[model samples]
Target: MVHLSHKFSTIPINFIPKQFSKHLPQQIPSQTTPPFIPFSQRQNQRSLLESQLISALNCCTSLTQIQQIHARILRKGFEQCCYVLTKLIRILTKMEIPMDSYAKLVFNQVENPNPFLCTALIRGYCLQGHVKESVFVYSEMRKKNVLPISFTFSALFKACGVVNDVDLGRQIHGQTILIGGFGFGFDLFVKNSLIEMYVKLGFLGCGRKVFDELPGRDLISWTELIVGYVKAGDMESAGELFSELPKKDMVAWTAMVTGYAQNAKPREALEFFERMLNEGVETDKVTLVGVISACAQLGAAKYVNWIRDTVENLGFSPTRCVVVGSALIHMYSKCGSVEDAYKAFKVMEEKNVFSYSSMIAGFAMHGYAYAALELFHEMVKIGIKPNKVTFIGVLTACSHSRMVEQGRQIFESMEEKFGISPGVDHYSCMVDLLGRAGCLEEALNLAETMPLEPNGGVWGALLGACRTYSNPDIAQIAANHLFELEPNAIGNYILLSNIYASAGQWNDVLMVRKMMRERGLRKNPGCSWLETKKGVIQEFFSGDMSHPRYGEMKQVLEDLLNRLKAIGYQPNMNSIAYDVSDEEERRILITHSEKLALAFGLLDINADFPIRIMKNIRMCEDCHSFLCAVSQITRRVIIVRDNLRFHHFHDGKCSCGNFW
Candidate 1:
């Protein structure tokens, strides 16, 4: 309301300072000549105009509206005002308007820009991902002798982070020291941003040194180094810094939660979430996502339900939250509730690549190949393109079900139809699909000749299939490559030995065992886990009878084994990786981890509820047969999730059809 234009009317034309006359516009002859505005009054008028322009820009939601305001700026003869022009530049950047278009034109109109204006333009280019152009602007600012602002160096550092250009970042770093001097007001900001750039570029030691050398540090400085350590998977260092943070915020808490989840320490992630809650830290969607993911990894239904209710209490619903829904789908499926996973997927209001892929992978993991294929088609029909992970799910479904033709078609269409070239993981899936279908030679050929060099997964897939189909010769080829690719992977050696034993080739099995001894590698003990009705996870190790109820568990297993033998099931001597006498092999087979888990589940789990068991390694032949018989005799549905896939046994049949 107190506009400069109204106040100027009360002042006389002759009252203008003589020294200020030249800065104002010249009077015209024909028009009733307006009074000459003094330089101080003009400055006030320009500030008022800029304030009004900022208010107007804030309300502009679209490019067209902002453009109209830009025309007003030009009409008011305020085009050269750096205060107004800098705001204009940033608004355009926020609107995602290209820097080359109206922004550059507006910036070019300012004859001499101050540091603020120059930095704003630099940030505009940086925000648009035009790092080269932003550097060019920095150079021009230097040529014009404009003192760079703290934000100018911040923008340049940010640009370097975007392009991952450490060399350019160092050049800017040198310039900061040369111009701003060490420990200057602007220098701290520049140093902080430099630390961030180095951390983001995967130089943790450099970031640490920068932090250590800083005379004073802020939360942001500490957080930058902490995140750097977290990204490097050095959670120990991250935790130490986090413990030292005086006042932690939501961002820092979320970082720890997500970091623990990403590094496969789900229990630690859950513990952090609880601690954060006790500290009265407000949780956001990001924090909730990390917690949800940890629950998914735990594969516990109680944890899943708690997180779901907690999310709803926090005003987030899986139906409306795509990220939450995707995480819930993954959790439910891993918990042996694929039906719940599908329900979540169906209720989601929005489905992104992650949502569809999670659902597809859930179906594939549960051996519902047709459902996975149907979801893929639906995703395509809805114009949601399949990403690399999506194709992995599709191919995995086909592999589990032995749908060779469908698998081949999907693999071929990856490049031609989806425009995503097959990655190494895709090739691995193809090998798995062909190998699991008893096409050992074809799978081996594809793995050996793929464009990308086969990683451990590719060879591992072939070797696993060799175990299933009893192909010792091809297993050797795969094992040799795996030995070179992953020399320390004891599973590969164990798989090769098992394959040889399956073929009744004891000498080759001895060779594999001898090689393992030579390399100082020992087989990992077979382990299994089953969640109790009370939500306690019970872990079992092969031949470890240390449980409180070990006597009862042994009796249960012996009774079941005797029944299995009476029903014509025999001990698979090859299942024992060691060359031992027949009696020892039978004893070892009965004491396998999964069988122990199965016996415990039968004794403790409710008859109505299906028994869910998780194994760290592949199920052996004798255990698989024994479980099938157990399922028929007890009239129970048994769900066993091994390292590779799920096996659903019901009424003397397995979902994998005795193929896996």
Candidate 2:
């Protein structure tokens, strides 16, 4: 299944990458006059043994068992026998047997290799993420007079795709045409693979041409074309083609759903799934994932519950089975239901590395950084190895807690013990960790030392820190870095402007906003959702009244402000970018996103219920402080999740210690 990474070898069967540990043997085809080996002959006994060994190799799942069989093959000096060599490769590839040592061992033993074995090795390298090695095997294959099969060429094209080498893929496409398989019956299969390769390489126009030229079509062919359209952001065409297909299978349905969900059209994917169900096609785990995701996007808690119940009733267990459980965790997290996510995680039967990672993210999102950190330790104790995502989660926890030293230790340990090099994301998290802890100089130095170019989020993190510290010099550097990478990242520019404004560099702030006008960059509007007694209603920008309870909402806010201020509450209007009278500023701050949501919560909910607010952007410092004060004065629990981490407010204190 495409949903599970470890379950199946997604690498196409025919063009198995050269990195796979299977062996292929070459033997000259005998002419019709030649006599075959007799079953009763002494040499035939060796052939029988070889056949049994190949069967054993095919059945082996563990690398240890494969190695034992491989050692016997080497001991008997049958390593050069193509038949045995090929089965060994199958075991290694299907089982995700590690690369390097075994791959080299297989390569050294193959003598006068079969075209199939050479091609398998070539493709295995790409699948195993050794693109350069796959290319080297192909070059060697050419030298050995191993005429390429269409599958061999397909593997080569895939290698080019892996390395983002479009020019190399084009060269191979020309070779495939010259080799005379361009118009054959299996042409669609080969060509679809080529076109998909180009899509992966980001040459959608070229990929489209290849797709237009294919002579026959299958589900794979249609999937490749649909994926090409989705990659190019032409989901309309992809959707059109998806609708017109006479025969629809799980792969095709999942492909379309994945495309839509990835492109932020989760609702459309859910609708597509409904049409699929109407056609009598029961949803698989893959489709269920997309369905839950779409519901999450809509924030339909009831709809998600229905899907969960159905999944259970259909005999589909939720655990580490595939990606369904992980998706559910994410869905609940995004919908601000961490309790439900925890319930799901607690009952899971088999937990893999990703299982803990998703739960950690859930806790982190809910402002339970302590829980997130504890889970990280639990992951290590249980021998569930950490990956880049696990470290990112830990770093996020440190950032949330303002634990600079803990972040440093984990960052260094990534290189020292794990031997996993920090990618740009890891580096970005470090900067966030340090920046949040008020170590501006160290964070800036780390950003400069990043092995890869820093993306927008890194500079944005630094800029935000500058805003907190009221630093102008480093803020300018972050602004320049951000503008260079993505000139239209409006958030970075606004943050830099805020930093300048906070530093009393009003002229510089004016200049920045002026430049924003010239570039047509507008600040993204803020939005908030308030769950009323009737239903959930949304308000945004400047006190949106699209809700059914508009008049009641206005009166509720008025009452809350009066009652809260009587209890020692005060408005902090420091986030206002423009000049205004003290009273006007205070009045405007009350209408801000979080306050508006809190007002709605005060009037609708039972006195004991907590007020939960989610913001599309980061919570302003003034709002964060105001929330703390509001919680204490009103004796209410206020939970807020902004562009960064969550904040739980109670008794004039925030869970983040007012750091975030």
Query: Among these predicted structures, which one has the highest lDDT?
Result: 1
Task: Write the residue-wise lDDT of candidate 2 on 196-248 in tens digits.
Answer: 89888878778767766766567777787787788777889888888877788
lDDT of 1 by residue, 1-660 (tens): 223223233444344344333433334234477679899997897676677777777666787666656655665667787887888888888888998877887787678999998898899999889999999999998899988888888889888998999999988888887885534334677779989999999988888887888878888888888888888999999999999988899889999998998887888999999999898999888898899888877766778888888889878888998887888888888878899999999889998999999999999998999999999999899899999999999999999899999999999999889789999999999999999889999999999899999999999999989988888888889999999989988878877887887788988889988898889886678888888889888889998878888888889988877887787887777666556788877778778898888888888999999988988777877888889999998899999988777899999999988866
In model 1, the worst 10-residue window by lDDT is: 1-10
Full-model lDDT for every candidate: 0.85, 0.74
- Show the lowest summed lDDT stretch of 10 residues, model 2: 1-10
Cα-based lDDT at residue 174, candidate 2 = 77
Listed in order, each prediction's TM-score against the native is 0.81, 0.80
Candidate 2 is scored at a TM of: 0.80
The list of candidate 2 runs beyond 4 A from truth reads 1-114, 124-146, 181-186, 231-234, 319-323, 534-548, 558-604, 621-634, 651-653
The number of residue pairs in model 2 that clash at the backbone is 15
